[model samples]
Structure formats: C-alpha cells, structure tokens
Target: MFVIGIDGGGTKTIAILVSSTGEIVAQATGGTSNPNSIGIDEAKNELLKLVHSLSIQNPKAYKNVVSVFAGLSGIESPKYKEEMKQILQNQLPEIAVTIDNDAVIALFSGTFGEPGVVQISGTGSVTYGLDSKGNRHRVGGWGYLIGDEGSGYAIGRAGLHAAFLEKDNRGPSTEISTLLLEYFQVKQIDSMIPLIYGERARTTIASLSKIVMLAADHRDQVALEIIKYQSQQLGEQITALIQISTFQLEGKIPVVLTGGVMNRSDLLLNDIVKTLKDHGINQVEVTVPKLPPVAGAVIAAFQAVNKNLDKISFQNRFLEDYV
Candidate 1:
C-alpha cells in the first residue's frame, strides 16, 4: 500500500507519494489551501486539484493509496479539522485521512521524529514542542487579532506603522517608506491603505516583510528595532514552551526554526538566539529543518500505520532527490 502526505499552508499545498517502505515516488504542488485564509470551499477545491493532479501524474499508484496524512493551516479548532477531513475524504473515498496543524509537521520534520521545539513564523507564528515522554505543548498561535507576535504579519504591520509615523513626523525618518512604496508598487504610502485593508489583508501585509528586510540590510534604525522586538517576542514564546513542556533544560535542546521569516532574516535569528540565552535557555541549539514539512507528514503517516520511521530505509536511489 502507498501513503500520501500533504503539507497545506497559506502559501501553497505540497503532496508527496511514498511507498510503504518509505521510497518517494512522486510529488505535486497546488495553490494555498488553508481554510481560514481561502475559506472552506476554496480550500476544498485546491485540495481536490492537488490530489487529482498527483493521481493523474502517477496513475499506477493512485488506486494503491491506503492512507493520507495532511498537516494543514486553519486547523486550530476541531471543527475546522472535522470539516476539512470530511471534505478531503469525500474527494478520495475509501482512503483513511488524518489532519493536523501545519506546525506539527514542521516539528516532526525539524526534529526528525525526535522530541524538540519548532517555531514557525510565516503569515502567522506559533511555537510547538514535543517532549521525550510524548507530551506536546503549544504557545502563541493566536491569529492576527490577539497574538501571533513574531509572525511575518506582525513584522509587516510594524513596518507599516513605522512608515506612517515617519511620514507624520511623529518618529525618526527611515528608509522603510521608500522600500514599502516599492514593495506595494504604489506612488504614495496612502495608496497602500486600500490594498492592505481590501481583501486577504493578513496575507498582503505579511508579504511586505521583504521591504522590512531590505530596509534593515541598509541599516534603517526603525526596521532593525522592529526586527529586534519581534525576535524577543519569538524568544519569549520558545522560552514559554520549554517551561511548559517536560523537556530537560540541563541538556542541549534542539530548537528548529521554520517559515520564511526565520529563514530570511539573519538579524532576527541572531536576536532570537541572544534573547533565548538571556532567558536562561543557555544550552539551546537552533537549526533549520532537515526535511521538508511534507516529508514530516510522510513520517506522521508512517507512525499512523503502526510503522517505525527508523525501520524504513528511505536511502534508495529512487528517493535520492528527497530525504
């Protein structure tokens, strides 16, 4: 039997087909399918498109698929998970489907199935961890309204606020205004108000972190301060996770960072590390994901079917292109 693993998020959906023995056969991609961002209907359509495309490309393995593990965004509530599971299962009947939050897959991929902490900072942010005793803990995944402090959206929002403050002479002048203008492709900062508040505002604002990064690279004091502040927020979340989980503080803890913001901003990464050390998380270790989140979904699928991840020899040449 074959297993299908999917990592669905705000930016895109990735599907991978792997054999029972962990050999990767094929992979496919589709547009964003996060139910919260695109609505349930659109999310279902995107899932269907993704699955159909994969099936079409690998017709020989389509009927052999036995199980599917999808780690998706907008699965914060059980209601969304149940609705999405029913929706996706309806598309491919007779196959068992399991759903979880995107952060879970990132954690699995980050730790390679071991116990560790994973921090995600894309359109939204969250820090989740699993301890050696199989205990799981989550912190700061509170969407844009209340939290998501260190997320790309937060950074972008701060960037916009800084630009406006500079424009009004309420704050020191910074190069972020020019960068924001270029990023939004607007003649003036006022032109962005409509777009930012128009539709999918969270995603639109989140994408503007690039401008903040550019400004910081050019030594924009305001931009650097924003990044530093966001880093501290992320560090606080991680620290909280460690305090809440059954993780050991004496030994080095592998802290994996995922998402666009974590990967793109060096200054933010440095500040986060610094903040962690300052908070008595001295033995904390940080690294990037060794495998993609979809691969992590595949690992979850292996566990779901009573299979051992370490027992699978996925090093065969057929799977050379993937981990």
Candidate 2:
C-alpha cells in the first residue's frame, strides 16, 4: 500500500506520494487550499488538482495509493473536518482519508514523529501539542481578526503599528515603514491602509512580512520585541498544552518549531528555545531539515484509519530523508 501526504495551506498545497517502505515516488504543489481565504469550491478544486497532479506525476504509484493523509490550515471545527473528509472520500471512495489541523502535521515534521508541540507562522499562527499516546490539543488559530497571534498578519500588523507610532511620535520611528513600502514599492502609507482594508490586502499584507524580517535584521527594538513576544506566545501555548495534557508529556516530548516564520529567521526560534530553557525545559531539541507538514497529515490520516502512530517515527524519517 502507498501513503499520500498533503499539506494544505492558506496560499498553496503540497502533496507527496510515498511508498510503504518510505520512498517518495512523486511530489506536487499548487494553489492555496484555505477555505477561509479561498472559497470551498476553489479550495476543493485546488485540492483535486493537486491530488490528481500527484497521481499524474507517477501513474504506476498512483494505483497503489491506498491511504491519504491531509492536514489543512484554517479548518477550526470538527464539522469542517468531517465535511472535508466527505469531500475527499467522494473523490476517491476506495482510499481512506484523514484530515487534521495544518499545525499537527508541522509538529510531526518538526519533531519527526516524536510527540511534541509546534508553532506555525504563516498568514496566521497556531500552536498545537501531541503526546506519546497521540492525544492532541491546541492554542490560538482564531484567525486574523480575532486571534492568530504571531502570525504573518500579526507580524505585518505590528510592523505597521510601529511605523505609525514612529510617525505620530507615540512609538518608535523605525525604518519598517520605508522598508515595508520598499518591499512592495508602494508610494504612500495611506495607500496600504486602503488596500489592507480591502480583500486583496490580506495577500498584500502577507507580502509585507519582509518588513518584519528587515526590522529584526536591523536591530529595531520593536521588531525584536515582536519576534520575542511571538515566541513567548508560542512558548506559553506549549506550556499550557504540556500542563493540561493527559498523557504526562512534561519531560520527554520533543519541542518542534515549524512553518515560514521558523524557517525565515533563526532569531525567533532561538529566542523561543532560550525562553523555554529558562523555564526549565531540558529535553528541548530542534528538528533539523524540517519535514514537510503534509507528511504529518498523512501520518494523521493513517493513524485515524488504523488508530496507530507507532510507525509514525519510521514513516517520518522515511519521508524526511526521502527528500
């Protein structure tokens, strides 16, 4: 039997086809699958297109794919997952389908199947934790308007707030505004205000994330604060999950950091590690060469169907090194 792993994100989707022995026969990427950002029809279409593209990449392996594991971001409710499961099932009735939050997959990839916590920084932010027994819990991911603390939106919004504060003499006048504008080649701040107020601005604001990186590079106090603050939020999320987990993950679970933010800057991840260490997390270790989250989604799907993550480590290493 073959396993399919998919990472469904806000902006794009990645699919990897793996043989039972852990060889990645094919991989494909496509447009975003976030239902909140892209309508369900568009999301489903993109998913179908990507999934089909995966099979098309290797016709021989496609016939052997017996199970599918997909983890999607922006799906907050069990109802949403069930609905998505139905959709995927309808598309391929013979294949078993499993769905989970995008962060869970990230955690799996980050830790290579060792139970742990994951912090994802993308258009949004969410922290989730899992234990040895496969129990899962989460924090954040409320979306851009309400929560999503430390996400791309949150970071970009902080950048703009710092700029405006500097402009108004109430906050630090930093190079972020100029840096952000330069990143987008915008002529005026007000221009962004209007664009950000509109639908397209969400995507536009995401592009502005470079401004945050630039600020951190230049040692801007606010930028540093933002990065550290976000790390703290993630740490707090991990701490909470660790505290509440029923499986007793206090000392052994690996702490995995993932997503765009974790990859973009080691600064934030270092800060998070330091903070956690300061709080007495000695078993802390980093998962190098991030495993694609879709692998975890695939693992989740497999586990959901068979109710076992025992081979999770083997599958993770297979795909992580498979690439």
How do the residues 1-323 of candidate 1 rate in per-residue lDDT, one tens digit apiece? 77788999878899888876667777888888887878888988887787888788787887788778899987777887888899769877887789988888888776655678899988889998877777778889888988998999999999999999988889888899988888778988788899799668988888888788888989999999999999999999999999883665347888989888876757788888888988888877787764678877877777777766553355242246563
Per-residue error for 117 in candidate 2, Å, reads 1.0
- State in Å the error of residue 77, model 1: 4.2
Q: Once model 1 is optimally superposed onto the true structure by TM-score, how far is the C-alpha of residue 92 displaced, in angstroms?
A: 7.2
Off by over 4 Å in 1: 19-24, 31-49, 63-67, 76-97, 185-188, 245-250, 306-323
Against the unseen true structure, what C-alpha lDDT does each candidate score? Answer: 0.82, 0.72
Q: What TM-score against the true fold does each predicted structure earn?
A: 0.83, 0.82
TM-score of 1: 0.83
Deviating ranges (above 4 Å) for candidate 2: 20-22, 35-45, 74-80, 90-95, 184-191, 245-247, 298-323
Over 141-194, each residue of candidate 2 has an lDDT whose tens digit, in order, gives 787878777677777787888877777788866778788667656887666666
Could you give the C-alpha RMSD of every candidate to the true structure, in order shown? 3.5, 3.7
Q: Candidate 2: count the clashes.
A: 3
